[model samples]
Target: MRKQLTQFMFSILLLGRAVAALTPEAAENVPFYHIPSTIKYADREIERLNKNIQTKPRLEDSIQFKAFGFHSDYLPVLSEIPDQPRWTLDLTFETYTGIEELFLVPTMERRIGRNYNKNAPYGFPSHFRVSQVFPDGRIQPVYEHNGKPHLSRMPLFIAFPEPRSSSVRLEIFKGAVEENREFFALEEIYATSFSYIRRAQSVKVSSAIESPPFWGLNYLFDQQTNLGQPLGPKNPSLSPKQQKDFSANFGHTPPGCAEIEIDFGENRPFGWLILYPALWPEGILIPGYGFPGKISGTIIPENQDGLRGSSSEIENWTGGSPGNNPVRLHGKGHIGRWLKLKLSDFPQHNGDYIFAMGEIRMYGNGRLYPVSGIRLEGFPKTEFADHMFDGYVGGQPVLFFKDWFFKTINGNTARYEKQKWEYTRQALEQRLDTLLRSTAMSIAVTTVISLGISITVIRKNRRKKIIELRRQISSDLHDDVGALLGCSMLAARHLEETLSNETDILKVRRIIDSTTKAIQAMRDIVWVSSDNQDSARQLAEKLEETLEIYSGKYEVSCKHDHLLNLADYRLQFSEKRDLLLFIKEALHNIDKHANATRINLQITVKQNRLKIIITDDGCGFDFRQAPGQTTGQGLISMRERANHMRGIFTIKTSPGNGTEITLELPVKKKPSPLKPRETTNESN
Candidate 1:
């Protein structure tokens, strides 16, 4: 229990350090330092972390450090066997020693792949951290070197640490939010084992026998051929060089069996065997030689000969057509000094029969063995055998082959972590995508609804203005022009009957003058409502001119004040119509009713509102009595028109006081359709 807590704390410290040092600038230095010789298998793996920290890596996989804080722990990172649980990463440092750093880099060592992991360029030298912990729970120097080598092989299976007097604890830390800091993670420092060096030794092969298609033996068990050295280029034809170096034969002559035999110096235990089929061009097996249709492999005692023990297999092997064929050795395999593989009853080729092979390899005693002696029998002397045994005994075994196996395991392990990460990320992004789609859809719906409302309002307002204009025009023709036309008709009839009455002629002339005046008045109304006269400046000038013409009938003086840039402020057709008509009515009242003389008009606009004030210094009438006693539109038409326009109108007048009228209207409101009044303009 105490050990678990210590390891937990160590994990926390290292993670904290990782978070702080996760800056892009700092990640460049991580994973570049060297590790002790007791750790490296053949080359340096620490330097594999590139200096490009431009994109931080991300790793989200589960890991545990069971053997990290203490010794006497045994667990593998992973077991290649499927039934076993995946190994967790663990590490240990020398107790009471110094602090160290570990860099975690994320890389899929391949090309710009069209596949999943290959395209993920994220998670490079992803994470970094410094560790300083001692076995006694004491602090150590910050940047110490010469720390014990804690990792030798790539971790694949769960493994425990060997016992020690004092064990080291790594500092605990957490990851950082900085993106560049996310490339990779070092879950724990492993307490590397040196015992593998002592327990592992070289295996010596005694001889090779009748592994006919002699060149095929070299293809399979060439000891000089190490990791990364695959079979040389294949050929369908035996070139002079191909015959000299690679070609081999395996068909039996007629009587004797065809097979290959390998001998170890003494009795040994066996675990597995592998055979690599020599490939011709396009991966076809060579034409003259094919795999044995019936073969038996047995482990016999070193002193005894013949198949005298329980054999693992004695049957026809198939599916040896393309690549390698590997079989696990079973039964009491310890008695064998020779692993004998016998082939007979070859299947017919072009005309004859043969069983050909490329290379053979065996694994036992915890190490890959080298073939010491090779013996080929039961064949004509003309067939040639290259020095196949020499290749088997030339190179170092563990460093050459096992290294490849372990590295492959590591790559597979990384792939496992990657698959899990992708699944989680994809699920989260899908939910986010759904939310964004919903928001966009809602916004679009709202915009469409608002547009519908706006169009309706515009059409309705236009209809209202049309109705109002027609009523005003109808009233003008009815009250003024109709009366004149009637009077003229009467005068013409009277003159026609009498022929020469002076009184009748004068009456006809008066009628003609009245008709002309009424027509001009109607024209003036039409002109006021015209679009061309929409500007305030134009309205003001026209108003002054109307006042001048009306006041011409009296000694009254009319003055108009000009508002600056008021013309720039345009008025709608309805606003101009109503404003000009109201002014005209007031002027008409002063002309025929108000007995006094001075009139002043001021027009101004501010903040999109137009204000017009008309003041008359004349004998005024009562405001209250004007509504009932007055004729024509009186106060009703003015008030109704003002309300329809969404403006305010006021009249200040009394028996002895001058009258003042004011109207304020908004420039943007569409004119409301106001109902016409029944009354007409009689007098003020």
Candidate 2:
């Protein structure tokens, strides 16, 4: 009894420690955190944690500092840009003890961290100061953004204004405090250990700028490499003038007229355009990156706007504000491939007479169409003329509170973030509501049926009723809902075929393809839930049809049902559901990630043993390698489903060798099964 008591006390102590390790108080004691590997469960765990944070935003306050530091490293994992040494800082706090720690870990940050920046520099925090600390502990060249002498919010990231000054110091004033409070709490400084990171050269696609054909032709200007870089598809506008001396790329259309055209490939809903003379870095415009004179731009409707056309012209913007303010052109809801921008007028400068500009921005789809589909006409070819599109944009790539356009466009950075959180919260609440209703109804039905069926074989009758309910749900989920989804998909396809514009066709096709995939998923769920689909042979048949349907979405060829002998291996509810999900996931993997062209499926059962094999000829990957953004979740899910079914799952593949997956699950009961149905690959 003494020995047993001692063991019990020891076990109790161990359990206490386990609980302590998970507590906020205990986390403060541990200084070091293991860097998270972005693979398998870690990615999923981070996603789950982030969703929780997004849904219950107030939960952020409850989070301990150490926990925040540990989790932030994993939650918002972003890919790192080459050559740019990414730096991240943390303001650690212990919610329970009110303890805090400031950390500056300038380690070679991975792309997949909570503070990860997908678009470096551009996507970094808009407001924050950066300082470099030499080995002597003296900081230099204090910089400030958003008129604040402070560091950014928690998990703050910033580019070294001077990349050579590796040793850095950050002065954080208020860490993630409520916004717009005057120096409320953000202020602190921390030292850093600059670890050396040698990364590969970043691969960004670019090409030499070719002068686009000018519609409503006026003249061609000099070809200079002065136009700023393409600032992504989403960046709305750039500063109109140069603050630096490097701006020199400029052009002027003759006294006659100037016009440019953009082909969006389809009828895209365009809203507005901002035309401003390139300010210093926004474009290669000379001197103050400002306009030399006032000018206006209008969209020509082929025949209107005094163009060689027929429709009325739409005037968008006129230079009527300070700093050569950009004119905002509201196109209403213009849809078509061809969009025209014509310079209406300009004041002559430098002893020449013509309209001129520094940069032009097209705003639609909540982003700027920098240079994806635009053509320029009429250039007075000069040595610097080609610089207009040489991809060298310099200006504030992002909007600050001071920007006039911010209010014009209704920019709400923080509030919208909360709005996003609210959206997620509402979604979760809806899901919870659905789950509660389902559980309550199920329980009520089960209890009433059990109590009323006392005369009927209670246990057997309840099970029969359950089976009937499942059948009804399955039928409803597929026959009714699935039919609607299928019809929508077909309608989208019909629209694609009937549409004259290739752009519209592509858009419709995308919708059709997505809807078709949804239908496949729905059918799989229904197949698993229906009581009649408990047979193992039915599983095989479902797998074959399912693979073909999914593969068709990727435009891949699929061959199935070359079966030898099919046995009715009956499965329980759990087995059937898991198995069906497994097959669905496998097919989904091939369709989305495999890049395969042809899929071959085999369902073979021998001596009451069941085996289902799916082979695909595509750019196969090594299963043992580290998972990337594409294959990580798929591989993890496939393995997890196989484990749930207690089945043997194996994949065989190598780079360029194609992939083959085989699953063998235990048979519950063997029944006399029919011979394999002879079906060709094209039978679907």
Candidate 3:
């Protein structure tokens, strides 16, 4: 039995050691006597307690107690579990090494799930209560509900008080619960202590809080001395009256307490402040008196939603309807930081408290800022033409003035300026072209008419000349040749009748022969003069006969060859005339001057030129030297006639030699339609 008891004691010791080892340091620090949950009693017992209590039964008596025992098997309660707390309390002792005074104020977030549990016996609480304990075994209760206390609820608590702390033991508590529980839960506990001391001091509350349009005021605390006015002294440059005005415009005065100081800091160029009067919430504006000052820091306007008007007159400040109130101004000097207020030129009446100032921001350096103004003028459309006219009129500035003047003054203008220059020039050119053509046509017509008239006149004159030549030839033939023939016939007749003796008869025969020669000469002359084919042929036959009559005086021969008919010769009168003249000259030359014992004469007519050759063994004279000695006029006359008929004449002769004369004269002949018999005559 003794061994069994010892074993049991050993097991108990081992169990205690395990429990001690398992407990955390934070859990050990907590006071063991604190209630973990509500304790409940029987109903009859609560009634008895109520009769034994004071005038009203305190609901605290109905409280029931439940022991919260440690069990490894049970799940840990949330209050028994450790957590990070919101409030921390601290205390410090000056005389001792330990703590002296401590206090804690916790920040509460009314979270539904964390502050209360629906699983608790009670419903949602109308108020919350908590108790704090100190190391000296003292306790205090604090209550709060909906950010206030129960006495603040009047009949419930005597007083709703603020927490207090001094240099002593400290305690901290909270009012909370699990979100699912119907009752509130307490999660954190804190305790501390420190030493305490007493002293006299001055405190200053800040005047930073003010009505709209008033700002830039700060609070100061001074423990040195007690004085009624917190702000020391005003700057000497500002008179009392000016100070009053400044305060009135700003809507708040500096705080009056010793230990508190008001600092306007630095007054920058082009910066101003604005205030709104208490009576006029919308009547807030920058004061005109501070227009040229600089801004120290940022200035925010009050009732900024009331701001209105064009942006032209305002610099550095946003101007619009005052939806987002308070325009902000920033920076240091005149150019970008200044604000100008045109309050003196305000359009509306200034009466009562209708005027208020908000903020004034000034912009420094006028060159960097822009100012705007408005102007009204009528826009003229017709006046633009007047400007052009002024430029172009006399004594005015004009482009290409010389060219314009030359054209305008000389009655010449550009094509576009003239009415119908193109049409008129084209018409004039066409008219000139037409006139030239007409003149050319007239010249051609006149030339043709004049040529026709001249041709007609020439033809008529040629016909007349031909007729006159025919008439002259006819008269010569009749008068000269006819008379000669008659004389010849009379001489032959007279010679035959008057002769009787033999010598005389022979002389008569010689006279008859001479008459016969004269008759032939007359016939030849007539034939040449007549220019007819029958006359030409008759003359040829008669010459042959006459040459035969000379056969006794000399060995004379005559040959005639006719290549053309008599009718063909008549049609060529000019050729007939030329041929006749050539023949006559040949015969006359032989008869008078040949002095030859033998002679031969040949005549041929072919195509045009007539050829005649006369050859004689005669006493030939030097033709070059004897032109004057010999009767050579017949040869000259034959050449002249041959030239007239476009023929050739030639003579060949030498002293103690025969003479040959060749005459070729052109004959214009027409071939006979009927063939004529060829005739060749040879006479000796």
Most accurate candidate by TM-score = 1
TM-score of each: 0.36, 0.29, 0.31
lDDT (Cα, 0-100) at 543 in candidate 2:
68
The sequence of per-residue lDDT tens digits that candidate 1 reaches over residues 1-684 is 234335445544644554454333432332322212212411222223221111112222212111111111122222122332121222333322121122222222233454544323221211112233345665332322222222322221222222232222222122112333211222212222221111101111122122323222123221211112222222224443333322234444443475567776666676556544332323333422344545567765554564345534422344233222222223233556676777665655555554444456665554566766666666443232332232221111112222333333333333433333333334334434555687788888888878877888887788667757765775676566767666776766666567677877677677766665665666576666455667777877777767776565554443433544665677776777778778777777776777767777777777878888887777887746765645456567877789878899987788878788889888743344689777757832
Candidate 3's TM-score reads: 0.31
Sort by TM-score, best first. Answer: 1, 3, 2
Model 1 TM-score (2 dp): 0.36
Q: Which portions of model 1 miss their true places by more than 4 Å?
A: 1-503, 591-593, 605-609, 623-627, 630-632, 666-684
lDDT of 3: 0.37
lDDT of 3 by residue, 1-684 (tens): 234335435544644553453233423333323212101122233344333222111111111111111001111124432333222222222222232222221212222765543222221223333333344655565443442331110012111122433222112122234453222212111122211111112212111122222111111110110110011122345433322221122112221111101112222233222211111222233222222122123222222354322222223332221211222243323322222232211112233111222221123322112222111121111112122112211111222211222222222112111223233333444455566788899999999999999999999898678767866865775677667757766876687688677788787778777767676666555555454434345546656765776787789787777633423543355655556656656666777877778889887777754567889998888957776854457767777877887767777788889788887765555544777667767631
- How does residue 145 of candidate 2 score in lDDT? 47
TM-score of candidate 2 against the unseen true structure: 0.29
Evaluated against the true structure, the overall lDDT of model 2 is 0.46
Give the Cα lDDT of each candidate.
0.45, 0.46, 0.37
**How do the candidates rank by lDDT, highest first?**
2, 1, 3
